[model samples]
Target: MFITKVFILIIIASITNINNTSALKLECTYREPDLHWEAFSRDYTCEGTIRLDGDDENIRTVTNTHREQMRNADVRGLMIVQQRDLQKFPKGLERHFHHLIGIDFEDCGLTKISSDDLMPFKELLQINLSGNRLTELPNDLFQFNPKLKKIDLSGNLIMHVGLEIFNNLQHLTMINMHDNACTSDNAYATKKEELKELVWELSVECPPTLDMLSSSLFGSKEFIDNIKRISGEDSDDVRNELLNEIQGLEKIVQELKRRL
Candidate 1:
């Protein structure tokens, strides 16, 4: 009878412990930078935007959350940095989080990243930098992360992609850049039509060119599939037709601007 009672107590203790742990992992969101400073990792279950009125030192110290964790970190899945007015990003972010499969920094006010900042994560699968204020992308953005599978840099100010940039990322599957300005003057401002044309251009240009250059470029098929998946084009033939139409419209707009 005593053994039976002890087993029942042990089962109850396990159940109680699990309930407590699940309750502790509460998720929430905040807007102000001050709120994030105080509640950095306290509530890991949160998924709210940290909308900053302006840059603050308090907000910049988010790296401290990971610093303590890096002593014996084993994180997998996503890390999101949403809607924050960040003047600076965490240094050595990629080194410490080696197991990170994805990173999302959507709607954050990011201007530039040092070339060395994201070069260490050879195993990174996806990086989503949508809706930011990035102008010139780093030349060696994909050099270090050779195993990168997907990249989303939509809704930013990026004008003019050098041929060399995409040439390096051979294993890239999905690229979800919907609205991006690729003009030198306003790289951050992308029109709907402009985004369409850019997508078409990248799709047609990236396939044969990438394959011809690198033998290990495996994800070209998936990359093309990704382009079709997002653009809603049935096939390459339809994509080409759409591209021509958008290009024609763009040319007319350019001509009007020239006259003005």
Candidate 2:
């Protein structure tokens, strides 16, 4: 009888532990003006900032309670940090705090973000997405956030950035692209006037396309087969054919160069 009672107790404890692990824990704090000035000095507001910290379960599960908390706060800035399970921008925040002017999503494990994720934040003035795993950004990611003044994309794995990504961002003043995979001398710019020069430099360093003819010729099956035949056998006909092809290619190159 005692053994059966102990077995029942073990089962109850296991159930309790499982329930605790699955529970979402969300902590929201309202920052007053004195506490918000350091992080949002450029765009300080009387509404202050609402900082939200949560575990993986809290991040994945957005309940009506969470939405009510943010709605009641009505802050201009929203900060969510250290959510490792967050692989993309949480669309739930937009529904709860669409009037947010600034957002800080640092140290999240974000791998991808689309334009739709940010289209709702039309009043956004600044965004900080540093220390994530982002590899690329869409060209029209900021089309809706025209009032944006500062952007922080540092400490990510972004490898390529299109010049079109900066289009229509005339109000942009500061861009922090440091510690990314694609680092150019002009990647970090502080002034709005330097945006044009930055785009020109990035274009020179990372062109949008490669020489198609050269790339195709080197990777073609016919080119590989011809090379193997020339090296494996002593066929004078094959050797002469290759030499004539090389001479013709040289003449074409010379003609193209003359035109240039």
Q: Which of the numbered candidates is closest to the native, going by highest lDDT?
A: 2
Highest TM-score model number: 2
For model 1, the local distance difference test gives 0.50
Span of ten consecutive residues with least summed lDDT in model 2: 43-52
**Candidate 1: how large is its RMSD?**
17.8
TM-scores for all candidates: the values are 0.46, 0.58
lDDT of 2 by residue, 115-156 (tens): 788888888888889899997765567878898888888888
Lowest lDDT block of 10, candidate 1: 23-32
lDDT of 1 by residue, 1-260 (tens): 99999999999999976554432121223221322222223322223233332223222212223323432144433344665655454444434334555556667778865446666666666677777887655435677777766677778776534334555666655666556664232222134454445545743333222222232222245545656664874677767765665576557556645653
Model 2, runs deviating above 4 Å: 1-26, 33-73, 206-260
